[model samples]
Target: MTTLPSSTRRKLGLVIDLDTCVGCHACVVSCKGWNTENYGAPLSDQDPYGAEPSGTFLNRVHSYEVQPDDGTAQLVHFPKSCLHCDNAPCVTVCPTGASYKRQEDGIVLVNEDTCIGCGLCAWACPYGAREMDAAAKVMKKCTLCVDRIYNENLPEVDRVPACVRTCPSNARHFGDLADPDSDVSQLVAARGGMDLMPEQGTAPVNKYLPPRLKDRLDRTEEIDVLAPFLAPVTDQPKGFLGWLDKALDKI
Candidate 1:
């Protein structure tokens, strides 16, 4: 089994806002497209034209309907991927050195060449983030767009995860979470961000901004106080990449 790094220099991860996400699946598609050509391995698809079709994707969005005590039901869109835990069990379970976390940026990645496709990593991961690539016979997961984010060939402003860049709702954010002053950290602090499953003791780097309750409140005074902070959905930028650039500038 491989041992995790004693400490990582920076915890680079994602901050997903459940409040603003619209369940568009734009981020899912963008992640598939960018990762198929750029990273660890080609995201494979089986039986594309056949009756049963299955494909590999690094990011996925799920929707759930929750009813509050007041009987108001809300549909929440949840985007999930590798959380890149500080004490990743997947890495520790890997018999080979293929599964390892980068000490520099804390991105967990699999070395396809060294991986034996034993599925131990997948079994060890509590989040179900690991996927077996049928074509390569190797396990794969989100690398936080490590190749693109650090690529010197790309423009400085374009150096972010594909999902973050393509999100139409501006719900996904990327930055060094270890830095208290980073935009992502500030956003997490302001929005009361939370870890997915804290009981697992993985200490996941990613955080989720819970949906705001102001919209559900019937009190006019409560709504008035939150109105100033909430931007009108209609007023959001329509152009996909254009809106991303604007949001990145703020971060």
Candidate 2:
């Protein structure tokens, strides 16, 4: 039903830079602002004015404290969202065909119009990336901002997703994962990056590169373990020697 070329397969994906990321919430805010307005459904809060308030988010930054057995502590902030995997389980589990991946750019998109309000997609996801749209009564997830990225009117740099554009630390990246020579691909190759929950065999196209940490011994606290023996000043006369011993004790 489409007229695009067969070789026009878009290898749509995200490349998050762990080196430059400062764990700022700028990307989170930018994603919420853009997707909630232009996308198919807006992320809404159930009881915004009530005691408990929660909203659907396509992107969330999670901060974790990692401690080594050698009494070393480290802070790790990980931002979680849909990986748009090559073997995406969310698409296969959808009974109504609402959840589908774009053949054009390899982006996972949800068709709210065809969705039957079933939460099957959410359960199938291992990353907890999908969230239900309370207002639309359907499952909602990241679209990679297809509407904005492909628009010819916007500048080339701004053509990327909102999250990538608004990142203060420039942590988020947008590019084609299939391209071995792409910026994202080159960065991953050089940085020794890693993926999240790789054990699930999802083969997620989106990769997570953990922040490099300093060595443990660099911060180890040093203290003198052995005490030096000192001569007994008790037998000395009650003069300069006694006073010196008292001063040493005070020292």
Candidate 3:
């Protein structure tokens, strides 16, 4: 039988559209579902029914309220996940060689068998993408559904990652960033895409398109225009001598 082509040269990454994402939590939920059941042990939750319950998750959506100078608030739902940085610091920090970037596809992955549970890679990740699977004592993170994406048995539509397949708003795209003609690249070019925390200089392969400006809400109407110019009124006396004379006049 002929040998299958290796995945070493392919470039893989995620594209998130801030303009279209409604912060519905579909991607987050779907990611949890796929990862929990498929790879290593289900994300390993601690104290599920307790007061401070938490679980390991590769993807999380954060909600931010941005307040403008006029006291207007905008609710921005930003999803936080591994951007799979081109210069991934996590890979270099791993002493066991468990964390590595695929030369063929540019996908960062952990070799579960070789991982020693040192937790160094997790500390190297600034996005908090890597989590220790407490049950397995190994680090876990987004694989980008590697198993599903390359499965020859699945239909073309089903070949993408579970998270991308389940996104209802179509806010996520997965493809090769190396090729400019790819759909993800086109979308990024059409929109002014940017990397989050570029100063960190991880060179995140993933890109986020900022949201379009919404209709302006008028806050000027809420403030009384004459309030600053209007004088303060008081029933009390002024200066001592003038007050006495004014009181005598009034009486």
What C-alpha lDDT values do all the predictions have?
Answer: 0.92, 0.80, 0.82
The prediction achieving the highest TM-score against the true structure is 1
Return the clash pairs for model 3, or none. Answer: 8-104, 8-105, 9-104, 10-104, 10-105
Off by over 4 Å in 2: 1-8, 215-251
User: How much is 29 displaced in model 3, in angstroms?
Assistant: 1.5
The model with the greater lDDT, 1 or 2, is: 1
Ranking under TM-score, best-scoring first?
A: 1, 2, 3
lDDT of 1 by residue, 1-251 (tens): 27999999999999999999999999999999998998777999999789999988888999999888874699999999999999999999998899999999999999998999999989988888999998979998999998889989999877999999999889999999999999999999999999988999999999999999746456566558677778576855679877897989899
Clashing pairs for predicted structure model 2, backbone only: none
Off by over 4 Å in 3: 1-8, 219-251
Candidate achieving the largest lDDT = 1
In model 2, state the lDDT of residue 175.
90
Model 2 residue 242 lDDT score: 78
Q: For candidate 3, what is the lDDT? A: 0.82
- Please provide, for model 3 over 141-195, each residue's C-alpha lDDT reduced to its tens digit, 9 standing for 90 to 100: 8988888888899899998877789988888899988788999989889898798
Cα deviation at 48, candidate 3, in Å, is 1.6
